[model samples]
Target: MSSALSTVIIIAALLAAAYSLVTALRDRAMGWDHLAALGVLEALLVAQMAVGFVKLAGDGKGPDDTATFVGYLIGVVIIPVVSAGWGLLERTRWGPGVIVVACLAVAVMVVRLGQLWEGAVV
Candidate 1:
């Protein structure tokens, strides 16, 4: 896995979380601004996923729990999409709250990915 890409994803995820949380705190509904920030995060995550797959396939060096790692990778990618959709449907401050949840999940998954990259078990 590429540490630099992972760091980018992690930082972006956290920033997304902070942005969403602030919006929620301000009692604002979901808007293009929130979507734009999360869109940037999603783009970075997509790049991270692509690079991750390349690394996994290249030289065959990966975590012991390959299935679990892959599962987390997939789940991390899905979270933002699902949460965004949910937010759009809800149409309230809860929309940003949903983003906060999604971003936090992605942030945690990024750390987990790093742990898995380092050969951590389970």
Candidate 2:
């Protein structure tokens, strides 16, 4: 895994979380901008997935628990898409609030991804 790319994903996830939180706090419901942000995050995650697979395929020096690593990657990739869908189901601020939670969850997953890449287990 590229540290630079990891850092970029982490930072972008954090920013998405912050933006969603602020929107939720302001009682702003889901909007185009929020969806756009989710779209951007989704793009980043897809890129990460591609890079991760390439790295795993090339060296096979990643986490011992392949299932978990791949699971996290897959889950992270699907989250924003699912959240965006859920957000559309409602017109309240809580819709966006749910997205905020999802963003934070993705951030945490990114941290875990780093650890797993480093061969940590629990």
Candidate 3:
């Protein structure tokens, strides 16, 4: 996994989380802006996933728990989409709140993924 990409994703997710929190606090429902943020985040995650898969496939230099690593990669990619759908359906301030949680979760998951790639038992 590329640390630079991971850092970018983490930063972006946290920014999105902060923005979503503000929106929720203002009692606004999920809006196109929130969805756009999620869309950008999703694109970054997909890029990261692709990089991870390529690295894992090359020269067998991956973590021992390959399945777990793959799971994280896939999970991170799915999270934003699910949350966006849930947020849209809710039609309340909690919609952005849900996005905040998803963004924060993605940040943490990206960190965990890096540790896993390094073979750390976290």
What are the root-mean-square deviations of the candidates from the true structure over C-alphas? 1.2, 1.1, 0.6
Candidate 3 stretches greater than 4 Å from native:
none
Evaluated with lDDT, which candidate comes out highest? Answer: 3
Model 1 misplacement above 4 A: none
RMSD of 2: 1.1
* lDDT of each residue in 1-122, candidate 3, tens digit only: 99999999999999999999999999999999999999999999999999999999895788889999999999999999999999999898999999999999999999999999999996
Arranged by TM-score with the best first, the candidates are 3, 2, 1
lDDT (Cα, tens digit) per residue for candidate 2, span 31-87: 998888898888989999998888888984778888889999899999999999998
Structure candidate 2, residue pairs in collision? none
Q: Summing lDDT over every window of 10 consecutive residues in candidate 3, give the lowest-scoring window.
A: 56-65
Write the residue-wise lDDT of candidate 1 on 12-119 in tens digits.
888888988898899988888877878888898888888778878985678888898888888888888888888888787899999998998898998899899888
Candidate 2 Cα outliers beyond 4 Å, as residue runs? none
- Candidates' TM-scores? 0.93, 0.94, 0.98
Please give the lDDT score at residue 55 for candidate 1: 78
Overlapping backbone residue pairs in candidate 3 total 0
Model 1 has a clash total of: 0
Q: How accurate locally is residue 77 in candidate 3, as Cα lDDT from 0 to 100?
A: 99
Better of 1 and 3 by TM-score: 3
